[model samples]
Target: MTTKKLTWVSMLLAMCVLGANFKLLGSIALDSFPAFLGAMILGPVYGAFLGIAGHFVSALLAGFPQTLPIHIIIGFLMGICMFIFGLVRKKAMGDGIMVKAVSWLIAYIVSVPLNLLILYPVLHEVVFVLFVPLTIATLANLLISELVYAVLPSKIKNFGQSKVV
Candidate 1:
């Protein structure tokens, strides 16, 4: 990666680390914003890296909860789906509200079922309870990503576009 991209990756990781601390709207972890932003700006691979690492780091700092695997898996899935949707959004839609909405919507759609499979086996809680929180958190992440995109400068926004995503 170039110096610029490396710098962004570092910055986003810090954002993810800090954001992970402030959860709101029930399960809506703030960490998702940094991860999604990283993906949207730097591309999917970096997003995934931030997600996986951020989730773990947050958990570690927060006392290493028992539900470690679930969080990690969710993070991984979030990155993957975001990358895929981003590609489709960029190619077919060419950056618009619908693209953001659908990309996020699809990320949630793809993650829920897959996550359910993992959640059931690991957490062993009532499906609805876990499902609701996850949904809220994911949705929050999506909205934040869109907001970040809107607020960012064009120069910074377009900085590393050719490198990834």
Candidate 2:
């Protein structure tokens, strides 16, 4: 990575660490914005890195209420989620308000099955209880990413983005 990309990664990681303070449930916090933003601006790989690290930080802060192994699994799942999210957003990129709206809608909708797929067997019915809050967290995270990405300078958005999506 270039110095610029490294710097931005550091900044996002810092933001993710700070975001751990806003806990929603157990280790689940509103800390995913940085990861989502990383996905948008950096790429899917960075998104996975931030997502796993971000969740780990939140889990750490919460004393690993769900146990370290489970949290580790969750962190990996978060990584997968970020990867898919980045891929979808990459394909969805374009001009037009309708396209933008559709992209946002798809980003939000994409999380449902991913959350349920792995979580259902582990969480069973308990996944239902978290669906709302996790969905809300995902919405908040994507909104923050969209808002930030919208305001960023073109140079910054395009920086270190070559061969990345």
Candidate 3:
């Protein structure tokens, strides 16, 4: 696909995934998978764009509440995290497993603080209990992103290869 098409596809996919995975204030959520997948398959810039688009959609859907600025900042940071994940993957340090593991690690490290201190505070309208859901959601997203990156495309590719064979 052309770059523009790829970007559009990635953004739309991210939005869909975010929409599907959204959780209010309870339970862990794995909303970052699409952006992570986009980062792995596409490039950092596209990943960032996809993340931003997804966040924007999610924020809009959630309704413009008091946390609009916080959402925007979180969205931008998420884009940066995805972009960095893409960059690390592009380095091709080892196999896909290692790349995804490290990328997930990086995302977790960055997201934990941002989610707990920044996003959650805005979300809960309080600061004390912010870490709970943020931690849960971030971990969930990390695991989900890693698994999706590790399995999805390869599964499809294997199925295609087997059919061809």
User: What would the TM-scores of all predictions be?
Assistant: 0.82, 0.85, 0.71
> What's model 1's TM-score?
0.82
Residue-wise lDDT of candidate 3 within 1-165, one digit each (tens)?
555555546564755465535765532245566676666656677677776766666566656443678777877887888788778876665546676677777877666665556666456655446466757766776666667656765643232113221
Per-candidate Cα lDDT values, in order, are 0.70, 0.78, 0.63
Measure candidate 3: CA RMSD. Answer: 5.7
Please give, for residues 1-165, the per-residue lDDT of candidate 2 as tens digits.
777788888999999998888988887687889988887778788988999999999999999886788788778888877877666666665635665576556556655556566767877887787788778777877788778888999877776356533
lDDT (C-alpha) at residue 155 in model 1: 81
Candidate 2's C-alpha runs over 4 A off are 93-110, 162-165
Q: How many residue pairs clash in each candidate at the backbone level?
A: 1, 0, 0
In the range 1-165, model 1's lDDT, one tens digit per residue, is: 777788899998999888878764333366767877877787777777877777666666666554666667766766676577556555553677677667777778865666676667766765556577767777777788788888999887776456543
lDDT: the better of candidates 1 and 2? 2
Candidate with top TM-score is 2
lDDT of candidate 3 at residue 93, scale 0 to 100:
55
